[model samples]
Target: MSGRDYDHRRQMGGELIIPALAVCFTLYYFTTIWNSPWTAQVSAFSIGGILLLLCAAFFIKTALLLRSSEASLGLGGLVGIEDVRNGRLALVLATIGYVWLIEDLGFTLTTFLFIAISITALGHGKNVGRATATAAVMSLAGWAVFIWAFDTRFPRGWFETTMQGLMANG
Candidate 1:
């Protein structure tokens, strides 16, 4: 009945959200691949099962922490940290934009721009040159591995289409 006890319970409840989400996702994944071949579903099944167990362990630990009155349950400290909130929001928005633009710009170009901008944004707008160079190298390496080494097809946007056309004509 003490205020301290109430606070501890609330914090434990807040910490439970992540484990709850993991459990939900694991169940969803299991159901989706339930009918697939064992070879195709093995990785998903293994990873999902491991994730579910980890979540269960987390839930138990948090519950025990609350029972022992070692921590408060309020979520404000975690979710209300202003600097982290802004950075996380920006990153999420950038990721959304990257996904939206990928079809039009193609994977290589879109990923390059996304990585550069994400690095700069996450770094609080410092070190633009390094971010750009790193992004370029990563994007090119990914393109080479996927397109050349693996011989997988990615969507072709304007630049890819133009290059293909030029090669055909020549």
Candidate 2:
């Protein structure tokens, strides 16, 4: 099959949105940090430049494929055909919920719950034991590092408040 004779409807055209957004963001970031200190802006500028170049290359390649009638705007097929799409959506919603509840649940509990839920959801209920153990270890390790090693003051919630009250009374 020649490049110009292929059906345009089955190509991965929908994947261009991310690169487009990255290009826009890189441009905006450069404009905002153009006058900042070189040391402060150096890393961002370098990364942005690289991102811009890669996005340009991808966009150009996609455009060429489209122009040659070798690609179709089959965005629906790309995301709709995936079996793990629902899992991905669930994980995203869970993440948003995790962030929203962090203040009320506090870091340790919220993080632990989030990690456990994420692992289970992404695993599709398979290997439940492994997911649970990994989530527990990861959550506890994160908490230890941030609270004990780094002394980061996470927000107080029910657990923290109850512990503090108990310590004060005892």
Candidate 3:
């Protein structure tokens, strides 16, 4: 076969990160909801069960793809260009930080920050102002829809509490 065909073949390495993370998160989700109400448990298990099946399917696909002689296990597939690697890493950090801080910061504020940071990172700082504006609008809309309209069980922080108070009084 040609070198071009060889290069076009399979690759792995950090490709496993996403599936591994999905499995871990699904498992954690299952573990946390054990004491939850039956309805909640049923919903969580249904979704997590799908996630596990998907991960299993992905792993099987990866295994089959790796069976090729041209398969590569290099880390190059993690991020294509070296320049954007930092940006991707920043985005990853932003996601981790978002998950870690969402409970304390409230849904609106945390979503705003996460979206802003993500946009800025992906845009390479070329659109920070626009990112901030978009983040604000999106976050407020999320609050209006999820917290105000639907009144879902999202974690409440300063913004949520203050907004609830304003709406109650006014």
Best by lDDT: 3
Candidate that beats the other on TM-score, 1 or 3, i.e. the better one:
3
Per-candidate RMSD, Å: 6.3, 5.6, 7.5
C-alpha lDDT of candidate 3 relative to the true structure: 0.87
Give residue 84's error in model 2 in angstroms.
4.2
Off by over 4 Å in 1: 1-10, 19-71, 82-86, 148-150
Point out the worst 10-residue segment of candidate 1 by lDDT.
76-85
Q: Please give, for residues 60-120, the per-residue lDDT of candidate 1 as tens digits.
A: 8877776777755667456665746467767888899998998999878888999999898
Report the CA-based lDDT of candidate 2 relative to the real structure: 0.76
lDDT, candidate 3, at 93:
89
> What lDDT tens digits, residue by residue, belong to model 2 across residues 1-170?
66545653447567888998898888898889888889879899889888988988988888887787667666745566363655787687889999899999887778778888888888787787887788778766866677646758976577556655776798
**Model 3: residues >4 Å from true position, as ranges?**
1-72, 79-86
TM-score for each predicted model, relative to the true structure: 0.57, 0.57, 0.59
